[model samples]
Target: MIKIITKVTLAVLLLAVSVSKAQNFQGQAFYKSKTNMDGSLKIESSSMTEEMKQKFMESMKKEFEKEYILTFNKSESVYEEEQKLDAPEPSAGGMMIKMENSNDGKIYKNIKDKVSITEEEFFGKEFLITDSLSTYQWKIEGESKKIGEYTCYKATYTIPVSEKEKEEYANFKNKQTDSKTQFLMMDEPKEQLISVWYTPEIPISNGPGEYWGLPGLILEASFDKTVVLCSKLILNPKDKLIIKVPKTGKKVTKSEYESLVQKQMELMNSQRGDGKDGIRIEVHR
Candidate 1:
């Protein structure tokens, strides 16, 4: 009788261990992001009426607010924006103006390997940008807050603009002949301060869109003019989530992609007479 009891106990322990391991390997997090559009719309336009500009700004604001889903496991994650119905293009002065959606891409990050791959589309051309994962020196503030049912702690970091970004900004400015518009672009800072809230309960050092290296999953992050917040989380769903790296598109490093884009912009500018008269191009990183 004693030998039989020991065998049953061992079997139950093995089953429990297997279940725990499975639970720790998969999760899905839903996030909603919004950007502050007030600064961007503050520029004075000579040709556009105030009412028309206000209407255009409203339309642009809608594009800045978006929804995303992050599927993650122990060491890897795939983050992509959720699909939504397209709205009609907003018109000003009898011309239809379209806002460029900057956050259209699939970001795959592998924390264990310290690598990141992003599939991006520019001017109808697709690119796969592979590079090292960015590391952050987070200063934990020892403050805590609750995001839904999970408790989160505060952390902050600073990031300086790269030379590539500076070059892009300069190119964008040179294309603008309006002094007011150029001044607005020049007012943008060269560095940004980021604040994040993460929960250790989840035990994953990943977040949405180039944010990671925290002690847990980031529930909320704010930097520059954008804020991303976690709205929901699901753990170990019945249907397994497969995290795969993007394989299609022209593969290039981060710096290489920037150079390619800059060269294309220069070519386009040279072809057009007084390119400043055309639609404004906002450089998106």
Candidate 2:
């Protein structure tokens, strides 16, 4: 009897190890992202015609509505946008949407290392931004909801707007066109609070790009007129995924990269110089 009991205990231990090895290391989460265009669209426009607004929203749709895949493990994760062939961008009165990040942009984070690296393109130049992980002072609220099969809880953090962001947004208004009407679409963003729903079932403190340190896997996140929600969860696929850290690009710290980008924007803004002819839109993502 003693020999049989010992064998049973050892077998159970082996089975537990096998289960952990199979389901706990790495997985993929698919997310659907969309911008809250309603705020901009609802801004009362006395001078801009409805036709102008429609054309502008149509052009902005492609840039804002997107799909992304996040592949994560115990401590490291990679987040990247999924690319699709897009139709030719529409334009209205020389006004158009321009994205600063390249289609190949990717963000990788290592929670154990407390670091993040981003691969992005700016003005035909590729950049690898390396920085310490930005932490959020998350306040867990007593709110819970069902996301898929898991129960998700809400947590939030708020960061003040940067002076540079404020200055750029202040300049984002329509120029005096030859038409009789004029309007301003953007409002200075205030109290930039972010909310995320996380589930403890996954037990990975990871989420979409730049969002981490949650108690569980973040299922949905929203901030600054944009929302990203996990649409599918695939845990422990047949083939193991390798989380490869990005190695290509000009290496620079996050602050250094932002400075370079600001310099380029200054040059462009000087050239743009309050043009007196058509609509102007400056959107930062």
* TM-score top scorer: 1
Q: Which ten residues in a row have the lowest lDDT in candidate 2?
A: 175-184
TM-score of 1: 0.80
**TM-score of every prediction relative to native:** 0.80, 0.79
lDDT of all the models against the reference?
A: 0.80, 0.79
lDDT of 2 at 163: 86
**Candidate 2 C-alpha lDDT tens digits along 12-115:** 99999977874466899999998866535432233457787677667766678889999999889999998779776656445666666434379999999999
lDDT, residue 146, model 2: 100
What local lDDT does model 2 show for residue 196? 96
**What is residue 87's positional error in candidate 1, in angstroms?**
4.8
**Model 2: lDDT of residue 262:** 63
**Model 2 — TM-score against the truth?**
0.79
